[model samples]
Target chain A: MVEEKEQIRIGIAEGAILATPGTLMTAGLGSCVGLVIYDDSRLLAGMVHIMLPESPHGRPSHPQKYADTGIAWLYETLMEHGASHAHLRAKYAGGSQMFQALQMEALRIGERNVRAVSMQLERLRIPVLGADVGGNVGRTVWFELPSRHYLIRTARGDERQM
Target chain B: MRRLQVDPVTLDALREFGNIGAGHAATALSTLLGGRVKMSVTDARLCPFSEIVDVVGGGETIVAAVFIRIFGTISGNMFVLMSLPSADRLLERLLERLLPAPRKAQEYTELEQSAIAEVGNILSGAYVAAISDLCGISLNQSIPAVAIDMAAALLDIGLMMSGDEENQAILISTSLVHDGNNIDAYFFLLPDLDGTEVLLDILRGKIRHG
Candidate 1:
């Protein structure tokens, strides 16, 4: 008989780390991005629900709230937990422009968040393996460790594996 | 702007603000629908960003939401949300035709979508107008946008516009009921930290002067 592994939920502006046989999920990601950095070989992963593109100040009290800081924090945390730096890869979803009619610059945070996450990941040299982002819809994403199955479910009732 | 710390008096003032705004909104809705529209200010308080969706239902609750960004003297986000059935029923009343039975995954037509947006426009306009009159501040609203999706998905835009520093928001939620029909809807007023401070200051001044 197989026992059920832990199912952890990452709330808005929050994150989690998991090892083999666990699932990390974050729901209702509108402008927020759900990022997963993983070492598939070792079945280790760290997930962050990043809310903003950059921290207002150089250092943020909540590092997981900003893409620039959150991505780095997730990467370093993964490395600290026995995940190899060379084998790290990323999958992310969300950062959707919820209201398409609004053209204001501030409303474009979704695009900014996506760009920030990508830039930070590139800076850390973590190659992005999969991404589902940028639309006028919200996404709920979950990463399954060991299997490395990253799944995305949109508000439109569409589901896909990333 | 300083973060808003809610005291008992401030909570009561916010509730009164919601009460006045919702009263005007209910009147506007009644005028538009040509029926008696009753509204109740259900819950008015400071709610964490994580719990805002739970007030309406939950993150996964499918809703038809009309969003408008408020600008000018203070800036914030306003949303008028309704359950799928309630939205359909409201559309039926506006279009004067029976809608098809609700689908598992319902999509609103462009016309239906506009109707909802216009309703949101009038409702928010009335609410903002009441606040403006009460506070003597000039406030403007952007064009309304409509979406049908999970509550959490739609509500997050409020938090995004407010910035990351604020984990909590001033949520003034009101429920509207259409007479002789089962139509029910919610109005959410989410003022960012700055906006909350300014509004609270104005309210405090009014209280002190009187």
Candidate 2:
């Protein structure tokens, strides 16, 4: 019997993680999406902490700063760590419109980002198996490594999966 | 009991000042947000710290706040806060095309520090320019430092309005509108005896111009 004592923690703010098994957590999702990818066979999982859907071109404000750059960074990092693209799957959480001062249409950055991610994932041939997205309230998400199960909590309560 | 007060005349002048400042900010913000990111200068008041409304950012949140320290006339601080929600919106617009996650805006990483700092820089500079032109004073606007909580935001506000604030410090607020969210920009300028006189003179000039 082997016991894995080297559990690592991924703090979500604009960062990435790749672990064969570890706890990746991000708290407070408000119109921001948390991306999680897991490769079952390898027991490898990675998450990207993104604040926006796109980071723009030419002038990437902070390559790891926005969703556009952050997500790209996550994948590349995962690839570097030995995860096969074919076995990867994703789960996302958080995308809410809370402010009443912004235009309903203008505030759709969250939705737009979600769309962008879906397209990117599709292009990468990675399937999205589960997600808890879009709401008026903020949430916290924890992706349990090795298990590929997503634990989510909100002001309302806690969700066991997805 | 005419014990020095800010009346309709003062409020109007301040409001007008806000209007002009906001107009300038609108142009700058629009350029960045990819279109006209709506903005409005809500209310202005002359009071002490006790009168200022306070907000708290959960410890988990990292707030990007920019503070510009102004010398001469009104020696105080001017700040622009993304107010978490607004920050999220701004980042979403800033990075909608590069990543593969649900379109929702979520999860912030340390990678955002510089970007948020730059934003703080832009807003603080823009605000100082507006105020300087309006007051017609050549004041310096310092680069903003990123802060973690609402208390930090208020403390920044406190610095300028501090000192024998035995009396209340005036509060001038601007609400920047974007994607249905309101970003609160607080401007706190405390006039030393000299600053008071200068502010009054500027107020007089604005009235004359109007």
lDDT of 2 by residue, A20-89 (tens): 4567776656556778877767867777655556655744544443565666777788888888888878
What is the DockQ score of candidate 2, to 2 decimals? 0.03
Query: What is candidate 1's lDDT per residue for B1-210, written digit by digit as tens?
Result: 334678877787777777888888888888888888888887777766667788668887778889998888788888888888887888888888998867443467889888989988887887788678678888999999888777887877787677654646666666667756766666766676566677777866665565
Per residue, candidate 1 scores C-alpha lDDT tens digits across A1-162 of 786897999988888899759899998888889999999678789999998898888878788999988987898889889989889999999888887777888788889999999999888888999989998887888999778989998777899997
Report the error of model 2 at residue A114, Å.
Answer: 1.1
Task: Note each model's CA RMSD in angstroms.
Answer: 2.3, 17.0
TM-score per candidate: 0.92, 0.47
What lDDT is obtained when candidate 1 is compared to the true structure?
0.82
True contacts kept of each: 0.58, 0.03
CA displacement after TM-score superposition, residue A4 of candidate 1 (Å): 3.8
Task: For candidate 2, give the lDDT.
Answer: 0.58
Best by TM-score: 1
- Candidate 1, residue B170: the lDDT equals 63
